[model samples]
Target: MNILHFFFGVCGNATALFLFLAPTVTFKRILKNKSTQQFSGIPYVMTLLNCLLSCWYGLPFVSPNNILVATINGTGAAIETVYVLMFLMFAPRREKVKIGGLFVFVLAVFSAVVLISLLALHGHPRKLFCGFAATIFSIIMYGSPLSIMRMVIKTKSVEYMPFLLSLFVFLCGTSWFIYGLIGRDPFVAVPNGFGCGLGALQLILYFIYYDKNKKTTDDNAIEMGPEKNPHQAQDQAQAQVKRSDKGSQNGRV
Candidate 1:
């Protein structure tokens, strides 16, 4: 059982690390294009907050400090900071201002939470408080894809939703859920359970809509073919008449 827990912990940390770095592709594209496009900084900001909270929850003061949790989430916090900074650099003026303000607000809230936890709570109380806060934030992070799902349904397309990311998220959630359950950490388990569900749903929606969109596009092309062919034939006939008239005049000459 201890071995199993260790395996799951390592796997969970690796998958979570991948999840944190997934946005690198998006940021790379933004840098190449020199535009933030329509990408929002909210997700990265929230992810950073989630990492910070998780790090706090897994601190050495806890009965059994989850070094794996702390290490991966700490790295996540640093990576997310880079992502957010790049976003601010390339984002439009309005977006820069808005995201900057949001970043500051989040920092203030995080500081207050840490201070209150440290000053008011002790030992297990502090651990529970931080754990609960981390759990809530993790759940929010899992549900962050809801907006993208809504857009997928509305547009009948999944262009903005990457299936690879969804798959990895599902895998990450499953690993963490197993680790949490075996380790008797409901705070970690519950949110990851929800994360698994949401990730699976996103993948399902992607497949359904991807096929639908492809079929729709094929049907539209087929429908346009007959309309286009008749116009093309008429133009050819007109050109043939002009050639015939020119031949007749040349014969007369």
Candidate 2:
């Protein structure tokens, strides 16, 4: 292999490893808070869908040359499916429904399109269709991180956005981009380019909000405990509830 191929392969391998490790933070949160509220399965669901689609796309390339790609993406699909299943078992009813819907949608629409096109097309046409479809799907998958980034900026809290996860995404995006370039696959490289940019933005937002909230939380600790003054806390909460109700009424009016 040439230097370019070696570099891209190493980078892609590293990025995939990072993707594999991204879930550690979620497990840590589950252990730390003893609650699953901090965990969201949407990202994992989307990732699993992406992996499965890639695996399906790589099926036509059974030239002994693309087996590595198929194996990695197939493993990713299985692992992601396991993660989603675990989340479904543990998550709230509402979240479980959402994940289920996403799973069905991906399985139905995406699988059908790829299957139909693969069977319908022939020879070089098959390669072209699969490559094109994979490229589009990859771009959409890479864009999934934007929602988390938006949530972080809106809340000004990285509570739902783990720094390590974002860092891995950044690394993953970079590695895949290089992999695509080396493999001469425009479908992979183009999307990962945008993915790398978004990943960096998420990491920067993490640092900005992490320290900003730390001081506020520490400052609040010195004040009266909502736990110690239950009545006061209840009244305060009720007042906020009333205020919210009034705001909603006014909006309706």
The number of the candidate with the highest TM-score is: 1
Per-residue CA lDDT of model 1 for 21-120, tens digit only, reads 6666666678999988756688788888888888877778752647777778889889888988998999999999998998898788679779988899
In candidate 2, stretches whose alpha carbon ends up further than 4 angstroms from where it belongs are 1-3, 24-35, 59-66, 154-159, 207-253
Q: Which candidate number maximizes lDDT?
A: 1
Error of 1 at 161 (Å): 1.7
- Clash counts for the predictions, in order: 0, 0
- Against the true structure, candidate 2 reaches a TM-score of 0.70
Model 1, residue 39: C-alpha shift (Å)? 1.2
- lDDT scores in order: 0.75, 0.63
11-109 per-residue lDDT for model 2 (tens digits): 666666557545654555555665456346666777776777666666745222344456667887887787777777777788789888988887886
* True-vs-predicted CA distance for residue 174, candidate 1, Å: 0.8
| Pairs clashing within candidate 2 | none
User: How many residue pairs clash in model 1?
Assistant: 0
Considering only N, C-alpha and C atoms within 3 Å, which residue pairs clash in candidate 1?
none
